[model samples]
Target: MSATVSREGNASVAGVNGPVLGDADFRFLREFVLQHCGIALSEQKRQLVQGRLLRRLRALNMKDFGSYCDLLRRDPDGEMGDLASAISTNVTSFFRESHHYDLLEKTLIPQWLAHKRRQGDRLRIWSAGCSTGEEPYALAMVLAEALEKHGAPFDAKILATDLSPQALQGAREGVYSLDKMDGISAERRRRWFLRGEGSYEGLACIHPRLRELVTIQPLNLLHDWPMAGLFDAIFCRNVVIYFDKPTKERLFSRYAKQLEPEGYLFLGHSESMHGLSDDFDLVGRTVYRKRAS
Candidate 1:
């Protein structure tokens, strides 16, 4: 459950180069990835996959692609997260898409908080495929402000999930480099982040208040989810670009089921639900609302 795949060569391997990925191994890998991660790898992407997975092969002290395939065959679930990480890109930033947050801050949250205050209901936002925690933390800032403004004792939380263990660990740590703070405004920088000093200089740790609102967890979007409760909104931006039509359809349908009626489903700028699913209606740029059934 992540964004576009990286085409860069794998340089993190222990060795200078990796063994060539054979045709049989490549085929097995394509099928395995599609089956497990819902990513359809075309024939042209073989070299890219080989290059990216080379680091894994070298790290595991493997000599051949066949052996890697064997490892996957033996323990698919155990290795799926790392495998997905190797192939997918975790490129994300705080407030990557600002307008979505604007809608939430200006309209959606106010309305929801008002209703929740009266109904004594909980507020939930699911940051599906929330890479490295930025999305959910940015979401938390907005949520915290709204809750304070409304002055309600609402049970509100943001569920931040990703398929990469590395990403989830980063999210849980809530620390970031100074350069990564570009998308964040100066005011938010002071308000929501504590600037580091001395040896930890140039890095900023997220405020404790934001951390309280977000629950970072590892999750694969294609697999079964443990969350039984429905969400008020789900932000799944940029993560569906690699999924094929059938996969997208299935994912969207599942998202609809997991959403409250009329809940929002936000997609990436490039993604579209057109001719894919009937459960959602296009409401704004890359934004969809669950159709009332």
Candidate 2:
């Protein structure tokens, strides 16, 4: 994959006119991010664009921003996602929104079970842009408890995706600092994690059992999703804060189509589908369900 991304190109910014970043430079990065990740950035965050992309400038040894932008255009295999991952914010932890998980256990899971018992359906969950695997692990904990009740096995899956390969790897490994586990309940912490042992002191690792229920993969949301069946619930969470208006519209529509009728969609509390789509109806809080058929 790295071989195809033009890593060894002859494009150099040495002695070249560099981007000084006035209105024009800011405009270039803003448009570039929108084109690449479907994220619409605020002009107020222009300082953010400068701070984030400056690393890219240094990494490529480019004399200025224009040369870096030119290099991005030439990377045939679409490594721009790597850059997007670098700039995008990632702030999530185990059960960050405990109320949502409470809803998942007390409300959503039971409803899904009732539907499954009636329709003979298998559960499907997608954690779009799952940062470091907590949502999926939390889902697994819910599913594991759900499975324990029936006294029989059921096939299920959690698809955890992110643009950052590093994040995906972290999600896959399922290890974390003890500090990140602050708000989780004692019972959940006990059940889901293996406390640090020996040389691995101070850090915790997700029990190997819970880790098996989820699959972590690299995904670029701006492109077509290579999936077939609809999902029973999608925990999109705070992932949409970076997306532009057009991207948000189309992406929600796609999620609407890919979700089972009556299936749920969870968004960041700050993210509202208000002007975006009516395909989903608000349930309690930030949770949403697809409008009945």
Candidate 3:
């Protein structure tokens, strides 16, 4: 369905040096994004969406939002990735929500390893919506430290996926500005990163050992997921807050199905599965364990 733009009542604000995003354009883009990515753009986000897509309009030499929307509709498969990249927020840092990592190192890993030791099973982690690389890299660091402490070879891998190809490319590159290392400890910085030099000065790259454990891929959570095995832990923090309630419920249910029995699911501090899904029991602050039925 096409959105109708009204000419009256301040329906559009003329953007700086460009065409304003009219009411109809905002409506269309919002629905399009939600339909394609399951990310609901609330009325409050109209300005934010306008600002983010302004650059795309300029890049495409489009005069207005209408043209942009038409382009998206015409070549959705080719342009959807760019639209996703434009609208997706990729703000992230190393070891964000430090308490989650603490829980991983001090509680979850120990318990998981004890059980896996008996079964000779490997650890599998999914960093859903892993923006750039920080979250998965932080997970890899924790696993690496735990493996060193255990003093035994334990097979483990982290699957880091995001919808934005641009973000995934950055994640795969595994490089970051030196300032972004603030959340990371000196010990970790020394052990897990290679400081850049010359033209690459003031940058850090994740050490090969840690990078080896993470596999980065582009994935849309709303689409068919090709993964076959259940994950021991899934880190989907700060992602579902952008989705509507039904989307959140469906996604949480999917996560529950993908998690091993008694496996953990970590959410952002602002998110919860309390009213959305019953398949998981609250085990920690914003942490849930799959109910073993």
- lDDT of each model, Cα atoms only? 0.89, 0.78, 0.87
Model 3's TM-score against the true structure: 0.92
Task: Please report the TM-score between candidate 2 and the true structure.
Answer: 0.87
Model 2 lDDT-worst window of ten: 1-10
Q: Identify the runs in model 2 with alpha carbons over 4 angstroms from their true place.
A: 1-25, 60-63
Q: Which candidate is the best by TM-score?
A: 1
Candidate 1 lDDT over residue span 1-293, tens digit each: 11222123322222245466656677788999999999999999988998998889878988667778889999998889899999998889999889999999999999988887888889999999998899999999999999889874679999999998888999998999999999989999999999888876889999999999999888999988999899999999999998989999999999999998899999998899999999999999999999999
Clashes counted in candidate 1 amount to 0
**What are the per-residue Cα lDDT tens digits for candidate 3 across 1-293?**
13334444324445455667787778888899898878888888877888889999889998678888889889886787778888877778998999999999998888888889889998999999998899999999999998888889988899999888788888998989988999999999999999888877889988999888999988889888999999999999988988888899899989989999888999999998878998998988898989998
Better-scoring candidate (lDDT), 1 or 3: 1
* Cα error, candidate 2, residue 237 (Å): 1.1
Task: In angstroms, give how far residue 102 of model 1 lies from its true place.
Answer: 0.4
What lDDT, from 0 to 1, does candidate 1 have? 0.89
* TM-score for all models, in order of appearance: 0.93, 0.87, 0.92
